[model samples]
Target: MPEQGMVIRGGAVVTAHEIKEADIWISDGKIVRIAKDTLPKATGTTVFEEVDASGMYLLPGFIAMPTPSLYKRKEGQTYIEVMREWVRSGCTSFVDVLQLEPWMSRPQLEYQQTRHFNSPLDYAWHLGMEAAQLEGRTVARYRELGFSSFHVTIRSPEEISSIQWETLWQLSASKQTIVHLHIQNDASVKQEQRDLIRQLWLDATKYWKVRTVIADSSAAFASREFDPFLHIFRLPAETTDRAVRYMYQRFYDSCPVASPLQEVRIDCRRRWCPPEMLLCLLVRLASTNIAKAIGLYPQKGSLTPGADADIVFLKKENWLTKYDLSTILNFSETHLPTSVMSNGKWMYRNAQFHLSIGMGRRIFDTKPNVYVI
Candidate 1:
C-alpha cells in the first residue's frame, strides 16, 4: 500500500458520476480532488505515484454482506474457495456477520495474529447476537469478550422478552456497538407481528445508533418484472386486493412446478444488485423531500473527496457499449471491475486477489463455493 497514489486520466473521473474524461488526485489512500479540466499549481510536477485509468469505469469497490463461517473458513482443511475470487469480482471488503458465541476458533486466532500482515483486500467483522441466543450464558460470555457490535436478526419469529432487549440496548449505548436486523422475511408473518416489530423498532433507536444496514424484503422489491423465479417473502401490503383476485383468477392458467407465483417464493439471492443501482437508489432516496435513509446508507461509496477511497476501475465497453452513457444505464448487471482498491491500497487487479498475508491456509488449488467447517 502506497502512502500516496493518484489516478490520472480516467473515464468518468469517479465511477459514481456519469460523465467522461477526468483525473483524480489521491493522498494517503484517499482521493482528494477530481478535475475534468487541468491540474493546478505544483500538481503536474508532484512526486506522488500515478496510474493511468483511461477508458474505464472508475467505480467504487464493493462491500459484501456478512457471513458466519469465515472465522473457520480456511482452518484445518484443504481449502477450495479463495478470497481472491471474490476480490476479482470487484469486492474490496467483506464483513463477517454471524452470531458467534464470543468464542474463538483456530482460524479466528490465526486471523487475529495475521490480519494486518497482508495479501489481497481490506476487511472487518460485525459481531452478531441472534435473538434465540440472546439470553443464554454463552452469549453473555461472548459479549464480554470484546466484540464490536450486536445484531438482532429477525429472520424468524422474534421473541418478546424485554429483559434481553434491555441487555442489547445497554450494549449498543456504550458506543462500541452497531446494530442490524433482518427485515427481508418480516412480511411473511401475520399483520399483528408486523405491527409488533415496527413498534419495537423504536427500541432499536434508543441505543447510540452507529451503523445499521437493511436489505430488500424480497426480490420483487427490486425486479422490474415480477419474475417468480427471482423472489421470495410475500407480504399482504405488497399486493393489492385487486391483484389478489387477479392472481387467483390466473391460478388455473399455469401448471404446478411451472407456476410463476410459486417461483417467487424461492429466490434467495444476495449481492446481485449492481453498484450503480445501489448508488443511484441511495442518492435518490437520500436526496428526496422525505429523504428515505435506508439503513446505514453511506455518504459516498468511492474514491471521492471527503469519503472512503475504495475505488474500482472496470472496463464496461467490452460487453457493454463503449464510449456512451448507455454503459451507465445497461451495464449495472454485468460491469464488474478489473481493478479494485481499498483505502488507496490495491486489493485486486488483473484477476488476482491480494488477501492479507498469513491470514489463512491455502490448501486447495481450485475455487469452491463452500468452505467445509
Candidate 2:
C-alpha cells in the first residue's frame, strides 16, 4: 500500500542555493516532486492531503550539530520536554555525542538507545571515545554497529601522539570514518600548546588522509595551511576578523557550522552578523552543511525530490522591514516555526505537538553512504 501523499503549496521553498515559490509533493515520507504549479492528486491506495502554507517560507528542518548531553534527561526536564524545546525551535534532527568509557559494555549502548525512545526528533549518535580507546579493531567494531563518526578530546599536545592515528587513518581511507577532535583549552593549557596540537593534526592530514572535523575550536579558522582532509566545525563569530577570513577562504564548502539554537539566539540578539548573513548561516549550519557532514545530506538537510519530508515553516511576518531576506533578531522568541514535519508527518503545528514517543528513529539503521565533503 502506498503511504499517504501530501501537497504543501502557496509558499516560498528555500533550497541550498535559492529560495522560490513552489509546491512540494510528498509520499512515503520522501519528497516526490517540487514544482511551481499545483501537482496532480494521488490515486489508488494513496490519499493526498493538502497543506496551505500561504505566506510561509518553507525551509529544510534544522539539523543541530553534535549535542554532548542531549540523551541525558536533565533535572526538572522530562525527556519529552527536552525534545519539545528542539521542536519548538525548529530542529527536526540532531546528532548526539555519546561518551563511551573503555570499560563500558554493550548494555550501556543499549541503554543509550532507550534514552531517546521518546525523542520527537530523528537523531544519530557519534561515539565519544578517549585517546587510549583507539586500538586494534575498536573503530572497526563500532563501525559494524552503525557508527562511523567518533570524537576524541585532547587536553594536551602529548595526547595527540598517543592516539592510534594509523588505525583511524586506515578506516577513514577504507570506509570514510570521521574523527571529530575537540582540543580542550583553558587556563591550564597554553595557546601555543593548542596551536601545536592543531598544527599536528593539520600536518597529519598531509600523509594519513584521515577525515577529521575540528569540533568547536575557533582557532582552527586561523590555520596557515589549508588541508582538504581537515574540516572545522566552529564558525568564527561574525564580528571577528577570522569570520571574514573564513568566508574569504571559502571554508563553508568543507567546514560545516556547528551550533545549538540557544547560541544562535544569543548571536542574533547580539546582532553580531547582519540578519541576512545570519539567515544564510542558519540554513547552512542548522540544515544543509551539518547534514552533509553526518552523511545525511540531501536526505535530511535538503528539500529537493527524494529528500526526507522534514521541514519547518517560517511565516511572512517574521521578516525585518529593511532587508527583504533578513529575519528578525528575536527569531526564536517571536518567530518560532508555525509548523514542523518529520518523515512527511506533522510533529508540531499551531502551538501543538503531534509526536509519538518512539516515532523518531536512528538514522544509521538505513546505512547512509558516508559523504566526505
Candidate 3:
C-alpha cells in the first residue's frame, strides 16, 4: 500500500525569486509535485488529505541564525512551549553553535546529539572554538563525525596574528568545511584596532582561499575588495546605522558576484527600511540565505519539488494590508502563521499544536553552496 500524503491547494507559494499560485503535493516528507491546474489522483492506499489554502500564502519555513541551542529546554520553559513559539513565528529550523572548550571528548558531542533528538524543528551545528584549536586537525576530526561548519572567535588583533592561518585554511578548504570568522571585541578595544583586525583576517582568508563567513560584520560591505570566497552576515545592530545600511543595500544591488551576502536579523518593527522592502528582505535573508549558508539549500529552504515540506501558511489579508510605521510595529503579531507544517505533517493548524517530541532530526555532512545565492 502507498503511504498517506497531502495536497495543499490554491495557495500562493512564495520563493526567493517569485510568488506564484500552486498546489503543493507532499508525500513521505517531501514535496513530490507542485502544479497549478491539476494534481495526480491518489490511488490504492495512497490517501491524500486535501488542505484548503484558498486565501493564504505559503512560505518555506524560516531558518534562524546560528544560536547556542534551539532544542534544549530553556529555563522556565518546556520543550513543547519552546517549539510551539518557534512554529507559530514561522521558524522551522536553526543552526546551533556548540561552543567547545579545549580537551572536550567525543562523549560531549554524543550528548549534544541526544539533546536534539526531541527537537520538532530540523537543525545543524557549528563547532565554535578558540584560535588555539585552529592549528591541528581539530576541525577535521569533527568533520569526520559529520560536522561541516566551524566558527572561530577572534577577540583581538593579537589573536588573528597568533592563528596558524596556513594550516587552518588548507584543512578547511580540503575538507569543504565552512569557516565562520567572528571578530568581536570588548568595549575597551579601540575602533581602529578592531578595524585593523577585520582587515587582517580578510587579507588572510582571501590569500588562503578558505570559504569564510564574516558574521555580524558590516564593514565587509563597505570595502570594495570583495572576495568571492567570502560571505557576510549582517545583524540588526550592524545595520542600524543608516550609512552602513545604505552601503549594504548598495553592495547587494551592485555586486554582480554571488558572494551570499546575507542578513541574520529581521526587525519587523523597524521603520528604517520601507515595509515592502523589509518584508522581501525577511523572506530572502531569514529563509533562503540561512539555508545556503548552512549548506541546506533547496532541500531545507525552498518549496520546489524534492524539497522538504516544512512550510508556513499566512493569511493573504494580513500579508497584503497597507504598511506604515504604526501598523507595522505589530508586524509579528499580525503575521503569525495560520498553519505550520514540518516534514509533510501538520504540526500547527487552526490555533492548535499537534507536536511529537522526537520529530526533528539533525542535519549534517553538508557541503555549502556559498556562491549559489
Report the number of the highest-lDDT candidate: 2
Position 29, candidate 2: lDDT: 91
**Per-residue lDDT of 277-339 in model 3, one digit per residue for the tens?**
445455665677667767888888789999999999888777656344242233344568788
When summed lDDT is taken over every stretch of 10 residues in candidate 2, the lowest stretch is 236-245
Better of 1 and 3 by TM-score: 3
Runs off by more than 4 Å, candidate 1: 1-4, 14-21, 40-46, 66-68, 75-81, 102-119, 132-146, 153-158, 163-176, 182-300, 306-308, 322-333, 351-373
Task: Name the better of 2 and 3 by lDDT.
Answer: 2
Instruction: Give per-residue CA lDDT, model 2, range 1-373, as digits (tens).
Output: 7667999989888764467789998888999889988445767767778889999888888876534477776543566777787788788888888888766788878777677766767888888877777654888988888888888877877877777777777787677677777777578878888788877876675567766776555444544564643564544334223332344347345543444444453223234545444455556655776677677888888899999899898886674443333333334455688899999989899989898777888888422235533
User: Candidate 1's error at 68, in angstroms?
Assistant: 4.1
Worst 10 residues of 3 by lDDT: 255-264
Q: Against the true structure, candidate 1 has what lDDT?
A: 0.42
> How would the candidate models be sorted by lDDT, starting from the highest?
2, 3, 1
Model 2: lDDT to the true structure: 0.70
Residue 93 in model 1: lDDT: 48
